[model samples]
Target: MVTVAPTYHVPVLLRQSVDGLNIQPNGTYVDVTFGGGGHSREILSRLGENGQLYSFDQDGDAERNMPPGDGRFTFVRSNFRYLTNWMRYYGVTAIDGLMADLGVSSHHFDDEARGFSFRFEAPLDMRMNSRAGMTAADVVNRYDEERLARIFYLYGEMKNSRRLAAAIVKGRADRPLTTVAHLTELVQPLIGRDRQKKDLAKVFQALRIEVNHEMDALEEMLQAAVRALRPGGRLVVLTYHSLEDRMVKNFMRSGNAEGKTQQDFFGNRLVPLKPVNNKVIIPDEEEQTANPRSRSAKLRIAQKLG
Candidate 1:
């Protein structure tokens, strides 16, 4: 068992997700979200001398988790959206497996300075790549009310999205929504006490999604993964939210983002990848109780067709 930093919690269903790869010792693989290098390390353990692993993460913090001078490993310090580009740059024509553990990483939420959680009075700067892109404060303070509403509704799945957006717009008119405390104080009034914490988490989730362009980036990475994977290659992904899970499920089923499968004249379903599991895998109660954040995880696996 590999150990991680105190702040970076171990991923749930770690062995199961890695086992889904059906790893080939000499085959090349990629771990697109190497949050704490847990999955990357596991992949390395299963590989032979010639096996290669390219782990991608935008956060500089993740780089700290890289294995100790492994020749087989390469850390790509960029968003997984450029999966194909990075592969091409490395002169790699195809990959045997690609695994992605999607959603805001646990470490991000645990790090108060990152502004992923509302538990602390931190600045709303939820950039995975802290060096780039818009901050959550930027989204809340500058985005139009309608756009804000859509982000909350789509990303956060909040029903009171419109009202929440309106409140932010109105509140920011008086004082900019700059910190977790600032946003929480302004919106806490609108939510009922029973669902306040849950809704507030959603509110932060929406802001984080918009600030990071997560959905768009995920779609791009999936499309690239499809093209990069070789025949019989495994695409094991652990998605945290319904929207991303749906997107992964659809792409694997139909070979497109629309989930529309194409068939030949023989009526054979023409798809690039086949779902390895008919049912999505989730953490059992025992595991969930141990790590509450793993409760929402949905693990989906697919294999590229010949």
Candidate 2:
């Protein structure tokens, strides 16, 4: 038996997310992003013997954190982007509730070799699934300046995207940038003293997003969640960044890709999902004090409507 790390992961918004599911004792459920199985274990506690839980985690390391199986739980080692297809493969048509906690796992950040944290000088790798495509170095070194600027602007929402891109281009001209430290040094001067670290974080975030195709994966997962849910099933998502939160907010409100509000001839709304709460939920002071990473988290819940 793999000894679970004493400090594997502290799932953010634990109460909020599990409560958001409104779990039914005998009903089937899915935790699309099962980091450390924190929410999954909580959901299992409330489930009856017949109840079933399907959990998905793309990171292979998460498998080590899995609780001892009891035939009631199933863990799928794949991205949540294929939620619908995977559910079908398991002979499940519709789930009573679905929970997705989308953020970098604490394990990933703590493992320096994974290279997620800016605090460490490690390889530029940021692939959630190590088996997959290009690393962050490939993105920084190979992408054109305009493309880099666009990623930084759209994903990171960086204000000095042009300057940052230019700096990267210039820095890489002499030799290919191959590590997180290399990129950090190149962009820090362009960002200057005020908010320099934060700016560099944004740039790194953009690179990681582009390298992993996070936005596109999120879109695919959202669409799959909507289609796989029953009419009254709930879709609860916890997002840490504005880009993801915006997409979730719009999709829940409009039930369309464009996020445009729809109305019938009688001026009735055509939204297929209704927000359980009008406002997003943030971590309480207590939670934030315990886990700083929980500070930026935003939890949003919606119930699928006919």
Candidate 3:
């Protein structure tokens, strides 16, 4: 097992994901989710002296973990949604590989003030960047009950999303739901004692997705990944939830998130990426035992076609 500091986020499928990139010693690479620089470090180790790496992270804390005096690595402090723009700005038109480890990091959960975990009684602020963007508190306190219900249903996959949204709306009418505890208390009656934690996690996931605009950002990033990768270059992604996994899988198969292939009038397929493996890659039992947080991780690797 690779050792990483608690403050630095532990990367899932570290070897498998990086290896999937099929790194060329002098090729250019991008690690779009440079949370703790674990994946970026692995990529750097494989690079030749002439190789270049561009790692993006909107969180300021992540930059602190970057290796100093590394002339080959450039850290971009912006959301991965602007990946193509930044790459172009840096005069990089095409890259050899790109990797994105989606979703919240372990550091976010460890920091109680972030409010990513319901186990803590902190302010309901779950912004990954934390420097900008709306907080979870803002979404819960201000969004219409219908909008909340839609997100809970679609993002969280909760069956009782409407009831949950109604409960929050009714509860917050008395006062603003400013903290994690406030939201938890309002939803407690609807949650059974046995599934309280799981149900609460679902609601929190929905709120975080909405607050961060994760789905939209992910879709934009995928489109950008296709444009930014060179022919035969790899796009490796590690997704934690079914929604994210579905998007990655569909895009890999059809070059679109809808999972449908498009053919031209000349009977030629227009897909950009071909799956490295038809089946999803998952963590082994040993890795899972070591890091339970990686249990839900699904890795998908695809290569850009010429």
**Alpha carbon lDDT of each predicted model:** 0.91, 0.86, 0.92
TM-score per prediction, in order, is 0.97, 0.95, 0.97
Give lDDT tens digits, candidate 1, residues 72-120. Answer: 9999999999999999999999999999999877788889888999888
Question: Which tens-of-lDDT digit does each residue in 1-306 have in candidate 3?
Answer: 323434666789999999999999999999999999899989999999999999999999898888778899999999999998899899998999999999888888888888999999999999988888789889998899899999999999999999999999999999999999999999999989999888989999999998899999999999999999999999999999999999999999999889989999998888999999789999999999998779999999999999
What count of clashes does model 1 give?
A: 0
lDDT of 2 by residue, 1-306 (tens): 223335668888887888998888899999988878888888888889899999998888888777785689899999888887899899998888999888787788788888787889999999888988899988888889999889999999988898888999999999899887888888877776888777777877787788778888888988888888888899999998889888889998998656999799999988879999888899999999999889999999999997
Compute the lDDT for candidate 1. Answer: 0.91
Question: What is the overall TM-score of model 3 with all chains considered together?
Answer: 0.97
Error of 2 at 48 (Å): 0.9
What shift in Å separates residue 99 of candidate 2 from its native position after superposition? 0.4
For residue 230, model 1's alpha carbon misses the true position, in angstroms, by 0.6
Model 1, position 265: C-alpha lDDT score: 100
Candidates 2 and 3: which is better by TM-score?
A: 3
Candidate 2 lDDT score at position 123: 93
Model 3 alpha-carbon drift over 4 Å, by segment:
1-6
